[model samples]
Target: MPASDALEGIQACVFDAYGTLFDVHSAIGKHQHRLGGRADQISLLWRTKQLEYTWIRSLMGLHADFWKVTQDALDFALDRHGINDPELRADLMEAYLKLDCYPEVPEVLSMLKDGGFRLAILSNGTPAMLEAAVKNSNIEQFIEKNFSVEEVGIFKPDFRVYQIAVDGLGIRPEQIVFLSSNAWDAHGAAAFGFKVTWVNRFGQSKERLPGKPHFTIANLLELPNLLG
Candidate 1:
């Protein structure tokens, strides 16, 4: 379907951080020389574990802040890959703090802001991480709010996590246009009543989840055209 079909009544725009806007793989990519051929494997494992930890922790009612979970996930990935350099682990964690936003992020966000949409980032990232990333990406001016899962102590696919955006913006669920690169995230928000767009940058398969996104776009650059 054309992206423009999803723009009808979105009063605010909420985004997912790690993969949707920022390039999460860039952290591992920065140290490809140190990781050698294992760079891609490590990056994949790190993200897989990072997300799994959140879901597992949430299900078990065991809450660890995202930063801690991020490190723990990294440790598991490094161990699995048999790359045990303490400095490299620390460097990878540090690199995450400044992941690069997608090349189209700044301009698209500026366009959305100029169009008078309330823009926010609702992610599982810790406030410190979010702040640093936003500042480093130089898109802080385009964001009106940053809603971290820390507020609710849960991760995405959970209703409360999506509720953060609703509460933070003081808008009904249907009024928000929720965007995420994760298919499950888009489904979750859709189930919660947000008009969702799954930014399928990798062209991944559809999720076997409860809800479906109203639209799908390959990149943020397609977003502004959709909004109007």
Candidate 2:
């Protein structure tokens, strides 16, 4: 795709993690394959529990951190699936550390950077997770920086989580284009005054939020064209 069209007034494109750039779901799916008949069922439980625990911990101010939340979630999922295999759980977590990259990611990020747009990460992932993902996924070269919410000790949809990018960039809110695969993150960034882009990969309907994205695209492949 050509960069002939992109979002107007967009100097930088900041991304949300866990889904936006990494194929996070693939981690569960691939590992669950070893579980045979219960693959999808168990995988779904793991992913759902992972997110649920994160939110619950965040709300309760328990703050176990994303890594701990991940492990705890997997434990709950394994119990639900009636699997007590430690090796299987280990395999699943390993897959997460080595998550697959979306095909369009490298090219799009390279093109965006070549097209002269600043690229950065704004994620709920821990500093280590974000760094590891960026390095292992081979998308690091294209990213200008990785911002983590560990500094704030909270989860996203909270205005503070989005600020990791703003404060990291040392730029005004209007100077950035906030992009996320998650609508909630998009909403939070938009509310914070960054021009938002909702990367609607699944074609999901937008949640009712006062902070709507400035652009919506099916995937990153369509983004360069859409932004223009």
lDDT of 2 by residue, 49-89 (tens): 87788678888988877888888888998898688998888
lDDT of each: 0.92, 0.81
Query: What lDDT does candidate 2 reach at residue 182?
Result: 82
Residue 163 error, candidate 1, Å? 0.9
Highest-scoring model, TM-score: 1
Instruction: Show model 1 residue runs off by greater than 4 Å.
Output: 1-6
For residues 1-228, could you state the per-residue lDDT of candidate 1 as single tens digits?
Answer: 544555677889999999999999999989999988989999999999999999999999999999999999999999997777999988999999989999999999989999999999999999999999999999999999999999989887889999888989998898889999999889989999899989999999988889989988999998888888
Candidate 2: which stretches are off by over 4 Å? 1-6
Q: Report residue 124 deviation for candidate 1 (angstroms).
A: 0.6
